[model samples]
Target chain A: MDVLLVEDDYYLADDTRRVLAAAGANVAGPYARVAESLSRVAQGRVDCGVLDINLGEGPSFIMARALKQRDVPFVFATGYGREVLPDDFNEVELLEKPVDPRLLIDAVARACRKHETSEV
Target chain B: MATLAGAMNGPGADRLSALPWEQTPLGPRAGWPGSLRAAIDLMLGAGAPCALFIGPQLVQMHNLAFDALYRDGSAATRALGRSLKRDDPDSSLAKAAGEVFAGRSILLASQGWTIGASPGTPAFNLSCAPIRDESGQVGAMLVLAFPVTSPARLDAGASISELQHRVRNLLAVVRSLVARSAESSDTVEDLAAHLDGRIAAVARVQGVLLRNPHAGVDLEGMIRDELLTQSADQDRLNLGGPEIVLPPKAADLMTLAIHELATNATKFGALSQASGKLDITWKLDQAGARGQQLELVWMELGVAIASQAPRRQGFGTNLLKRRLPYELSGEADIEFRPGGVVCRIAFPLAPVAAMGSSSVWGVTTTAGDDA
Candidate 1:
């Protein structure tokens, strides 16, 4: 599975990227802004995504909505509470910050597998 | 201590019946104001604990329920005829009652009553209402006390949990910092230096944030402190800027970036040379599309071109060129001139403030090219 990581905080972004890469999944561009990620998502190699809501400017809900339309599953990595997410994205998986590597990988596998089985 | 017969009922009434009513500041019972008379009647008829503060002195009178609150001694009864306005003026009840006396009825969620100075005294929920005379002039205060539920303990528990959540979030960020520091280091020593310096920079910012939780760190102070520790002499630096306060997250990243730059200068740039100069300056750029932007420039001169940049494009370079842009939604430019290295960073500053006509951090044009 290919996982696209989008986060602004460099340490968390770099560290999360390492964790996802180590789990044997191909990782896409760890883009910083919405425009950058939105363009990358349009090209279509991404299977799953791990997005941080607050991208310095605003939450990545714009990207989240796009992913939803594409039928791709993803987890939200946030230091903030659930109120930060809207009602539409409430059911999506949430990964709390300083994310545990094993949990992150498992969440990705589950997200991808979830979509796969529903199709089956 | 003869037949005193106060205008009330209850143990407090019994206590008032025993006191020499005509002698104290309260004066004789019949001579009491009509407001006091009515207030006493209302307090005694209450099902819960109640106190009446009467007259200009605001002397206290209570019912059996109010007297029962202090079970150890007759302290609550003794407190009768003591002035809530004057006797224990600093007391919480007195303060609330003062408002009632001012013709405003105040219902408090919780208040401390000086029934006894003894420890483990429970807090009371007090409701103070204005008691007016027959002439419609405010003359007394009627205070009702509810059962104690130990809300202070509950509030402390909530604050502790809030504190715990914050600590855990902070720990997570630190954990990520540890891994990132390790990733950029080429060797064990490099890792230690990178980790220690980055951690210390974070600690410095954390200290400022803790001291002033609302207002953030001043940009000028950050640059001075960061470079001073790098042993860059005061005379070798030209620091200028309009005072800019960076919010917590921005402060953390900026401080780290400054640390990286200072460390590089100390090792190879201006600070390492005998006749070198380092100019650190910043200004608020108001005319940007993204509200206000703060632009900072770190320039060094008099050091050799070989040591201008770190051998590897490590933490400092990546932070200035890449991480800063991603995290701050900003821009950065790092140029290694033959004589030194120059780095310019710009980011949006929130709560766009307009100060007196902005001061220019004069660019020292003489040293940019000593090649």
Candidate 2:
């Protein structure tokens, strides 16, 4: 399983990477900036992605839009409440920050599983 | 002119004579018109803040009461002989003086005027009338000013509004802290201790913010304050970082995260032993596409093997690993090295101006680092 990770916080990204790796998913590009993450999304090889909404440069909505266009499944892992999420992304899954490791693993697994079902 | 000399010889006579009014637009008093001299006598003898703006230039001649109103003596002295038009272009006094010069008497009941940007700006009420010569032409503008009682209350409503907003946000943060702290604790004692520490961290940030309400809290200073509270001997800890001002929310979150790290080091990490050492260093990474990013590293050295794996997944671990990244839009890498724990964190440093006004909830993609 190939999972895309986009988070600017080094510690949280590494922690999420460890959890995903342990779940047997190959984490790709925990890209810290929006531009780099968008470039990785353009490659189209990611099975799933976990994104932080605010990337310091700005929000990751552009990257989310690109993923949505490609039919790739992703979840928002952020500290902000759901009210802060864009109205357009109302259907997407959101895991608030200080995420439980188990919850993160389930979100990624579910995203990857959903992607597989949609492709099949 | 003799009567004008008599007025000057009265109370505050020496101080009035000491002023170099001879070089002013009015010139020597001996050459003054009779109408102007009589007006000066009336103004000098009055027990109120009064001033005479003479001629079309509106050259200023004020009484001692007016000088005491100025907090800065140099500012008061600097105003002497200068035209009111040049001294305060947009002030009510200037505007009223203009109207009085045009032969219209204006009585302002309670117009407000702030002296400066100092914490407490003194406010005043002013009134003015045109002083005419014996020939009936308006020769000068006579102005009277009185200090407003309880001027602080004049601006209290606005301050109270902002204060209410801040207090609400702080309460929300505290609620979140309490909930999160409870989730990671194993026992009641653990929860109590953890909640106390987290609340203290929030309070510390609040203290710094209150001291300098306009400027944000300093990053290095916050970390040092948190670390010092945990460790008795400062020699065991080494901290190095450039000065960075964090927005209120960022400062609060960072203080909690630092507190967590220091607590871990004290209980089951490097600081658990006397020989243990801790080094924390940070630097700005400016080559990012969006804006400057801050990369901070925390490395613990000389920890006993027993302290390496103390509860693998706890509140401290979750906070460092998840909360920081989610809240700050930063990255974190926590590794249990052979010697001790090594945590590296990276987050974008939003320009200071954007931190307070910009909706912490609003997401935008603007790339300019205006700081």
Candidate with top TM-score is 1
For candidate 1 chain B, which ten residues in a row score worst on lDDT? Answer: B352-361
Model 1's TM-score against the true structure: 0.61
Clashing pairs in 1: none
Report candidate 2's interface RMSD in Å.
8.1
Name the top lDDT candidate: 1
Model 2 gets an lDDT of 0.72
| lDDT (10s digit) by residue, model 1, range A70-116 | 98888887665565567888778987776788988888888888888
For model 1, report DockQ: 0.18
Give lDDT tens digits, candidate 2, residues B1-371: 64455445334446556666677777776777878878877887789988788987788777777775566756665566687776677876677777898899887654355433232334556678899998999999988877665423433333443454355445645665676677678889999998998889879988987776546788888888988888536888888988877865567667877888888888888878887899999998884674778888999998877765655587667766666666566778888877788989788776533322344324343543222
Q: Any runs in candidate 1 off by more than 4 Å, and if so which?
A: A1-4, A21-46, A53-71, A80-91, A118-120, B1-169, B286-288, B304-308, B350-371
Q: Which residue ranges in model 2 land beyond 4 Å of their true spot?
A: A1-120, B1-158, B310-312, B352-371
- Candidate 1 lDDT, B190-265, residue by residue in tens: 8888788888888898899677544668889988889877878999999988988886668888999999889878
